[model samples]
Target: MMRAFFNRIFGAKEPEPLPIAFGSIPGMLDEREAAARAMLKEQTRDPEQNIRNGIAQLQLIVNAIAGSEHDPEIHPKLKSIAKNTLPQYIRAMNTAMAKELPNDSEEFYPAAVECVKNCLNSIRGPGRYLQIVFPDEMKASRKGIDTIGREINAITVALGAYRKEMAALSDARSRYAAIISCSEDLAKAAEKNQRSRLRIDEMTGRLKEIGQEMAAMPSDPGMAQFTEMKSSLHQLTVQLEEKTRTYAALSMTASHVLRKAEKIATKQKHNDEIAFLKHAMALLSDHELPSCTELNTALAAACPVVERMIGADEIVLKNKEERAVFAETGRFCIDMVQICSDLHAQEDTCRIAHEALDAHPIHQKTGSLEREKVQLEAMLKKERQSQTELTEWQQKTQERIPVLRDELKNKMEGIIGRTVQYSDVFPESA
Candidate 1:
């Protein structure tokens, strides 16, 4: 009776538990396995597409975190998470994708599955606070969250201001560095100009000396040699004069450029240093507490000092230019003396050559015909020797000219390059 009652209560259709023989349902497990295999095959075949979809989703999360407004209904709870927490979620997602996507086996599948699970969990769990904080339900309590958000916004605004102040300070420092470089370059150029001027003066002095010696040569036995010496001296004097003029022009140009650079440096040192200090003060005030009036006073004080430095630099530049001019004048005089000396030496050589020719027996012969033949032979020999000497001198001069010119050109180019590199004459605005 109890068994019948139990059967009736439970439903006598306690159908004999379906026969549980493995072979009886032959294809059941196999179908399940096949279905799973087919699903896996589909996923494997389009891995690139899956990865692209994942990356797109990641970008969406990143964009939302970066401050994109989202529909509260669509993202529900994500909106309530702290602004900093979104970055953490992104990092976790990236880690999971990296671990999961490369392997075909189940090992990585769990990581991918976990990534999705955790993301959903995060939105439903602690991230629910985000929904409460930023809810679509107008009736939800949001006063506290709004107040905190406002405070954070104010802090961010302050930080932005501080960054601007710091940037100004950096700019000021760069200006100062440029100014200092220009000043140093100007000083060096001034020195070089002075040296060049001095050299020109020395050359001029030597030329004058040569001119005096040439004028003193008399028509004596050695007079022919003196004449040749005079001619050579004249040529050297002309060359020295030309070089002196060129160096003088170069000195002027250098002096001008140097002065300009010095002026620019002075201006920069005066203005930029103060600007840097002001910027630093601004940064300090932003980070700490400082009065605006104090910054204004500091800037005012800096301006006059900068102007004074600029004036001083201008004075220095002027002095340097004058000194260079004076030195070059002196060099011109020295070159004149050198020209005289060179002429004297050339004259002496000519005299020796003439004397040797005169000492030959050809010139002393008494018989007209015999003398003529001897004179002719002597003259021919002298001509041949002269031609050889001239050819040697010409070759040596040609080789020397090109080498010297190239050296001069290279030196000039180096100077120009350095000047451009170190000078702040160019405007920074461009």
Candidate 2:
């Protein structure tokens, strides 16, 4: 009595919510579906048999219509019209009912509804004329239809709620599946983020070590020896350059005269000497250094052809540079051959010095460190960019998860008709 008095004064307390584990949502949906299906089976058990009996009643009505005799007082025109149309109506209704009914409720409901429609249509169609012919039989068929309709109405009402619950369960299951997939994706992203951070830290540490080593490298004793070797190589290179210019000036002057000789030789048909002059010019103009001994041999044979051509006055020297190099043929040949030998010797010396310096330990270590640092910096940048992208994706997915969770909660609540409180909380990280 005290409780009743208090209840009258205040609204009833809200019912306690059902507790659901987040991970068990799929299982819950399966259990709910099975329970709903069982409920449907219980409701429809008697209805199904009633529908079968109702179909049997319809079949008897059709057969009775086929054999029903017209009353003596009936109009001849009405009897004739019914006689013509009754067979078609009976055939159509039987065909509608004759179809094999599905065994499952989802399938059976529609089939039963269709059978009901066919039964009603048969009575409402041209079978209306049977009222006068077989009034008693027509009355019994309508009462049978009424029996089937009541059962159908009951099934319809149960199925409406059943279908709504199943639909909500289906929606909840789909939303839950999406949430699971997103969670897995988030876990994978977090794992990759962990690896990326480790790699970035590793690369940054290596870069720092390289910087420290490179900063202290200038004071190392081996650097002095490396510098000394570098200085020696530089001096050799400068001398080689100067010697190369001197050799080029001499070769150009000699080539200028040789060209004139070759043209004359072509006209004079001196094939042997033309070959010699062209081969010598090739040695001089070649981008790669020609063999110095081979060049000396070629020039030894080729310069005299230009000398004889000058002696015959068939070719004239064009400039003072050409005259100075080619006027005294014996002196010019001797000078050119000596300078070619000197150039070859200097090139060999410079090449050996360069190789020796490059092979030094300090030079190799410094170059290796520089290359590694560049590679590490590039890798670090790439990792950092991936970190940013992973963070952005995590943020968006974090926001989306809650929306999906709430939606799932609402859908599950609709399915069960009870507030659901999730037991398992989402993890902060993997």
Candidate 3:
């Protein structure tokens, strides 16, 4: 009957023990083997089925005690069990129930405990009151189980949202890291470009100085000065070439940095840093390496003209000072010449007076006047010789002035890089 009851409750699919092979033994004691098989079957009890049997027995005992409530001591014992033992049993069951539920499962007992406590408080007079409150306690337990289910579902949903938020935050942090690294690279690149620009400026200044010196050289290349100027120019050209190569490399690097910056700008659209990078890149592109090359090349091409101008300026300055001195000397010579002519006339007068005095020496005593005329004659000869030397010097200088002027005009034309024309030499003069 017990076996039939277990089969009916637990079903045919429940595990069964293997039958004992009593026939395989040669000289088996049938009675002893049957006893051993029975003992083995009795020892192998199913825990769930046993628990069900125990619960059924407890229900039967409670029902029997309730039916025999005329007994006085049984009611107190049942009350003690309700107050302590049942709660402990529920706790043990909850521990077992946790194995089936999630780790973060909600509390199942509070609502049930509260409900039972409230129901028990309402029924205070007698021990039989629990029997009356049992239905309400069961209802509260069911409600508490529903609350646990709902709370578990809610917690599961919230955890999902939290995970998603964490993922988004991680993505944002990654982008920030990329931006920081990219920005640092750009800063280094910009600094490199700035250094290159400074080098280019220094080299350009040196080239310009060389060009100016070359311009100031004599137009004749065979001159010792021109030879030295050409040597200096060669050195400057070498330096400029090196600087140009360095500038080209820097420009390539700048271009690379700009490309990266553009990508960053797209990635971080609406960012202020990207806007600044764009502006700086535009400025770099507009005013950089190629402009330097163009300016230097232009300066080099115009060097010859500048040289001719420099030579012409020197000639004009030197000739101008020379012409002024010649004019003053010529004026002094003219005055001396006039004085010499007057002296010659006085000398003639002195000679004639002397001859006259020789004739009238005896008649008229003019010895002091004759001595004065001899001194005047000697002074007149010296004055005429000095005037003649001054006149020759003045004439030579006056003759060279036109040659100097022509040379100045030729030099000026060379500077103009055209035929000799007044307008060409000085456009403003024209």
lDDT of each: 0.44, 0.85, 0.41
Ranked by TM-score from best down, the candidates are: 2, 1, 3
Q: Assess the local accuracy of residue 368 in candidate 1 as a C-alpha lDDT between 0 and 100.
A: 38
Maximum-lDDT candidate: 2
Error of 3 at 385 (Å): 86
Clashes of 3: 0
Clash number for each model: 40, 0, 0
Could you tell me the TM-score of candidate 2? 0.76
TM for every model, in the order presented, reads 0.23, 0.76, 0.19
Candidate with the larger lDDT of 1 and 2 = 2
- Each model's Cα RMSD: 39.7, 4.9, 48.1
Off by over 4 Å in 3: 1-76, 85-135, 192-430
Clash list (residue pairs), candidate 2:
none
Taking the tens digit of each residue's C-alpha lDDT, what string does model 1 give over 74-138? Answer: 54345544455655644553453344344443343444445545555544544444453334321
lDDT of 2 at 248: 89
lDDT of 3 by residue, 284-388 (tens): 354433233342333233222223333455212234433332234334224333443443454455555545444542312234434544555555455555545
Model 2 local distance difference test score: 0.85
**Top-scoring candidate (TM-score):** 2
